[model samples]
Target: MSIKIKDFWKAGVVCICVLMLSSCDKWVNDTELPDNTIDESQLNSIAMLGRIEKGAYIPGPVIAGVWRAGATSAADLLVASGAISDEIVPTAVPNSPFYKELDEDKLTPDNTSLFSVWSNIQNYRARAEDAILNAGSLAPADEDGVKVKQAALVNARLHAGYAWMLLADYFSVTNTSHSIYADHKELSHQEAYGKAKAYWEQAIPTASDAEKRLLHSLLAKMGIHTGNYSLAVQYINQSFGASENFSFLNTVGTVSNGFFNALNVNSRDAAVDPTLVVALKTTADKARNPVVKAAKGHWSLTLLKERDPLVVSDYEEMQLIRAELIIRGLLTGNATDLVNSVVVKYDATGLSNFPAGPALTLNDIVSIRRIFLSWRGTRLIDLRRFNIDGDLIPGFTQRKWQWIGVPEIETQK
Candidate 1:
């Protein structure tokens, strides 16, 4: 059989078995499940487990109703968060009313956008949790295939932890209870952060070099938020030797990058803040500016073509974290040298026309960070952090978020 057919056949078989075994519900509806469901006994093979892992990264149809591929991944959530924070603006009404609400900072319980974000976040979390929970339960076909289980467990934990962190970061009202089979109660933001930290820490031991780097970056943010600058610094130091940029693969069948989709394909929304685009252009910051375009009076991003990769975390973020720590006196380093190092490095890496001779201020670190991490969804948090520290950007708008409580869908339990 062709690879496509083979993949389809395997996915179909796995879906049937998983649904029957896991108690299909709202996300994985039983009525829609394939009739040719396989028996649970057939899942012991390593090949079948590999198929399950592959399916975990595939966009929904298994869990969430919409098959957004990668759009609903981190970038999409970033879009929602950006929209809520004034980093993105609405030109036309979005399909999801919740996004409109987010743009207005007035989300309601019944908003579909809220449910979509909540459901997608919870669905990813459930899949990750399932992989971790089932890691030891499944019997490998071969006696010495222990590596497969460990790999799967580590991958699942990494995704689960990050998903949990995303939930804590974006969702005002958090839910720790996720699973189609059982109901879970809601968690406060602090409780949610605890869950995120636990999963991240659990995954760190067996994570690959690159995965460990990504986790360190995330844990740094966690530490900073929890007022443990020491822990944040330690995590950054451990993973600082190399630049590990975690990007969302925007291949065909996997969704396109969210920014490109929303601003270019959808055209309903664009970058609202002109100053952001202006800064990138004037400062010779080619890394962020060229991707921004203006047409018909709408400013949209063209960073990724159809399948261009979207960077989620990288060296730039690591440097910013280090810079922030230095500014706060958490890490022992000259803040100016650290910030200048970032400038010098970026200049060396194709920013030849970098405006020269300005000593790096703490605001410069934050501003450079803003330019480098633009459209990746870290803008709002950076603004918030800096604003809290009285390092306000001259023309930045501070968005106020009102938490939308747990939706009725989850409350049905």
Candidate 2:
């Protein structure tokens, strides 16, 4: 694509947005940036693309902040693992039981969590769309620039579309046609899902090898959930060889250089401390704001890995896709495609575990997702989308949470 200087200036000015339901029209379009030296070539620069993509994951906590009540969203797993359950909000006083019950679906929406992850996803999607738009407006000419731009464009769309999908599937509400730029009309449940799939279709072709694999796996979710077995298989094939390893951070003992310390804006994400949890729970009666100081480390170690392996893209994801297609009656492809992917190719002696068969199951797929995504901020959407086993979430679904009781002030006894 040819890039006129004016177009380059425009691209740099307005940040991209992804939420179609509530699209953002940036003000920068009216006010140009002071540094107008961006070129189409920058899109391909690893240095450039890396910097831009960092924005996507960094600000995610802004949305998570609300989800965890007053605590950071980082507490998501810990809450789910059930460590901080008794760190009662002093406000939880008499109403806490009924209200808490309601929040967890043990009660109802009459008991809503502090925030709607469903709605927050829209904001996230809009942010992603903005990034894609930036990619589109780039006048990238170099080979590397082309690759990075295309990858950015595809991932940007993927993030936006997935956000919308999460919103529709998880929440009690559903409105997909809300707008890519502005509200057009309210879309039904299926319509919104279709919109998400359509967006995924358009963007999938442009993804990098790794991204393609990730999308391929994700497409299976959207398609299978919707009964489009064949479409799911096709997308899965498109994503072959995407990931081959999975790894986790080994940060607990090395706190000063750990992942928690790196991302903990509040300096509160320490390793699981049983004593701290009990201490905070007991002090609740004397506390002010009780939500922030409750459980310190119940779920933090749920699946804590000493060292996460880099699970790269492999044919295994494709095999599972094929298998699901067969189960759904959409494809006649040999199940070997699926079977071979999971067959261990190497043993302790480093020989092929060869010709493995039917070892994978639906449970296996879920396990893979958990290992792969870990605490990468992908679970909240899934948890909202009918919970772990495709069971409808009870109206009283209490999302994972953390409560840091507001510290007490000294008083003369």
Candidate 3:
């Protein structure tokens, strides 16, 4: 795969990383220093390790067409998954067949979107593992290099663990069927969460300030996925300052933030699912008012122009998590007040296009999350996690982890 960071690849420079071996023979051959092998001396140096780390992040598009997916291109996955829930609806249903399948919740094993997600996640996991294990083998030449190499390894492990969590949370697979490692081991959800937590724990002590903040945010997410709300709240508290929000960057040729291009530019899908407006209309709450405007018979989400950065974690999510904890009596606060504060803040700042209504509750919290996290992804997961799959919305379907379609590469096993 080629990575283009603002036309640098056009300058004839190739970014290459030693990804996990495809075969046991190749794995063994790596130790013998074959002709194609990365130089051992280079691998031992901190400079080369830094390059490998950057290579892992280069957005390599994976699933094409309707099921666009990539290693780093999670925004695409957001849009695709949004179709499965009542968060996003397709504009051209007849032309875009995947939208119909996603809308109806009829996913086959060979579904292109599922296959793309499965393949890309495994590759990412392998790449991260390669970096972590290889980096462990070398000692840095200087103290600064040692810190840099350690940070890279920490980030690599975090990425690998996250891939495992995504696989476990989003797909149903057996150890023998969906193995990504040479050993052919597939982890259960609990096992995946365990691995993710371990990686975060390993990185925390040595991580730099910014890296540590990211680790905390990710750990909080893992906690939410694993049904450990208390842990999630604890981690979110340590994540960052109340005002801080985090985003990952994307470039034009190298990384097209696929959410904007596919939906707005290509005109392939509708901006916002119309259900949010419909739900409020029927709720009979006089105080309820959300800020979705109709354009040409559909909601106009024209704010996110092309080239907008995607938020990785934000204060809205952190507070929502806390609000849920408060509602459950696990935390000490008025859940309504906490949720309304966030909602009012979003509306006051005009940061969120969706305006907050009066006298909010837990349901409002969920609604605000759907609005705030619209293309940020988490719609289907929230539905599944809350066990309200077929509720709330009229035609909602239960989204659950699915077994992967047999890939061509798996046949080699």
User: How many clashes show up per model?
Assistant: 1, 50, 0
Candidate 3 has a TM-score of 0.73
**Per-residue C-alpha lDDT of model 3 across residues 29-91, encoded as one tens digit per residue:** 345554334443444345545432342321111101001122343654566666667756666
Q: After superposition, how far is residue 82 of candidate 3 from its true place, in Å?
A: 0.9
Candidate 2: misplaced stretches above 4 Å?
1-103, 106-116, 140-148, 174-185, 242-301, 305-318, 332-413
Scored against the true structure, residue 316 in model 2 reaches a CA lDDT of 51
Instruction: Give Cα distance to truth, residue 354, candidate 2, Å.
Output: 15
> Which has the greatest lDDT?
1
lDDT: the better of candidates 2 and 3: 3
> Which residue window of length 10 is worst by lDDT in model 2?
404-413
Pick the winner on TM-score between candidates 1 and 3.
1
Candidate 1: segments with Cα more than 4 A from true spot: 1-45, 51-71, 92-98, 139-144, 174-183, 240-243, 252-254, 291-293, 340-362, 386-408, 411-413
Give each prediction's root-mean-square deviation over alpha carbons: 8.1, 13.7, 8.6
The top-ranked prediction according to TM-score is 1
1-413 per-residue lDDT for model 1 (tens digits): 11133233335446644543454343322453354444444443343334334424222222221112223557658777666554566665445465566656556767665666666666566556655655657666653345566566666666767776776666653223322211255566667777778888888887767668778877887776556677797798866444567666665344677777766733655554455555665334654545445555656765667677767677766767787787777777765555555555546654433344654466776676667766777766665555542222223344345233445566554
